[model samples]
Target: QSEDDVKTHKGEDQSEDHIGACRGENNFERIPVAVSCAEKPYKCSECSYSSKSSSYMKLHLLTHSDNRPYKCSECSYSCKSSGNLNKHMSTHSDEKPYKCSECNYTCKWPGVLKKHEVIHSFDKPYECYVCNYKCKTSSCLKTHIRIHTGERPFKCSECNFSCVTSGNLKIHLRSHTGEKPYKCSECNYSARTSGELTRHKVTHSLDRPYKCSECNYSCKLARDLNCHLRIHTGEKPYKCRECNYCCTQSGHLIRHMRMHTGEKPFKCVECNFSTSQSGDLKRHMKIHTGEKPYKCSECDYSCIKAGTLLRHMKTHWRKAKLI
Candidate 1:
């Protein structure tokens, strides 16, 4: 047919094809034909449903009723289509549905699998108009926009603790309830978050997968690699507001601030002694318990503090020096 004739037919059938059809966004193809001839090239025998592709009609047939032909022998799970049955089988087989080509990472859900695949690709499709902040996915760019706008939609009902990401909010909620859902199977040790549990599991293994580019330094966790990178970059992002002091770690800056404020949060209940640090409080508690944890291998000498044991060992070093 001519190009003009095709356009005329398409315009005439556009309204007819959309009468009982899925919206333009939902459907992949919009085959617009003349109204009288728009009964679809392919029609379903069971229903008024019609599609240009038989595959689309086949999908619709599955939703007609709960008549699942494909069944899983391991479980009560069944599906109308073989494709869905294959996806369901992955659950019982202990296999990930989608795996990344670049890494050993795998995920059960397709949406999560797609997100994982983006990390391997160099494409950054989404970008912020305000700051030119680029992200691999649109969802990530949307979250990044919140940082510039200061739009914290996710808020905790317990307090004024607000965050940009939903994952951060989820991890924050565990703090209030003291919930440790991720547990180590090798030991009784559990963690508040999966990332913490993953780090704990690395202690059991000697393997350090993440390595630094600038130095020979390697670490078990990606976060440790990031922290090591900062040492080479000399990027002390964490700074004490009270003083000119800056640190690679936020924890170090927090402790430095405490020295200035004299805010000793950790207090010894038995005595008037208080400390700005948890480690100092722990050592103080050992005084009440008479716990001599540190010991010298060369002598039978033991001490409450590790520093005290090290000082005691210096006497033996001096004796060797005299000889």
Candidate 2:
């Protein structure tokens, strides 16, 4: 065989003696000829992954299969690879050895720290085709693409709840399991997600780090500060599709949309009462409990709603004006 017809295991040109030895009739050490110099011959049918190594291609194929041999002892978490199972096991503990240099961020995995470090840098290579959104990693760009495409791949078995990312689906599953993995160090308070725990931790501290430049208003969370700034800026970003109604918050827009759809999502467990808003459902619950929180100072009139108490006070005002 010609020198060009055979190559070493490392994709390198070998000596004539080494090539002759590999060319033996019963030689099992004969390395396969590479298809291209720079191209990866092994390609995945499921995804865009490609590898030059045959063993790596075999390992990558496992990602497409439902055969997960490795399982977690603490949870229902399972994976195809042992390395991934080892990484997931660290999440059950509070041990975070990897720390970010730019911030107080710490994670159990080195790859997570590497991803977190990108936030400190101004470089964002991945850009969205539909929007002006840019992110540091390709994984983040993939998640952002789902926003424009409206593709929710991760689904919940318990409900119709579906999300774009697996991380979001994992958090949503916690609602059914009643699992609060993130806990507050100062208090006994716990939260389903790290962001919720972070917001809760601010309540323990007296200092309000997020302050509004337009006003003297300050808040523990940056989210609240942004919402407060919308009041001064008149930036009603959340708009109703059915009507010309616009709102400062997404929750307000969701509630407004329910009015258009006539969706009574908040239903009373005790009675047949149902409402579009959660607060309305809460007030309905008070009726079943016989809890008249709103009382009139003029008389023994009491009600479940504040609006009823305000109307009762008007009766006193009318009597005083007549006197």
Off by over 4 Å in 2: 1-92, 123-150, 230-323
lDDT of 2 by residue, 5-123 (tens): 65454657767566545344231233455456677755666788877665676687786787989988987767798997897678668899999999898988898799889878899
Model 2 lowest lDDT segment of ten:
22-31
TM-score of each: 0.48, 0.61
Task: For candidate 2, report its TM-score.
Answer: 0.61
For candidate 2, give the lDDT of residue 79.
76
**What does the lDDT come to for candidate 1?**
0.71
For model 2, how many clashes?
A: 0
Reference-based lDDT, each prediction: 0.71, 0.75
lDDT of 1 by residue, 10-103 (tens): 6643455454364233333344343355456555556677876656865886776768789877656566889878765664443565787789
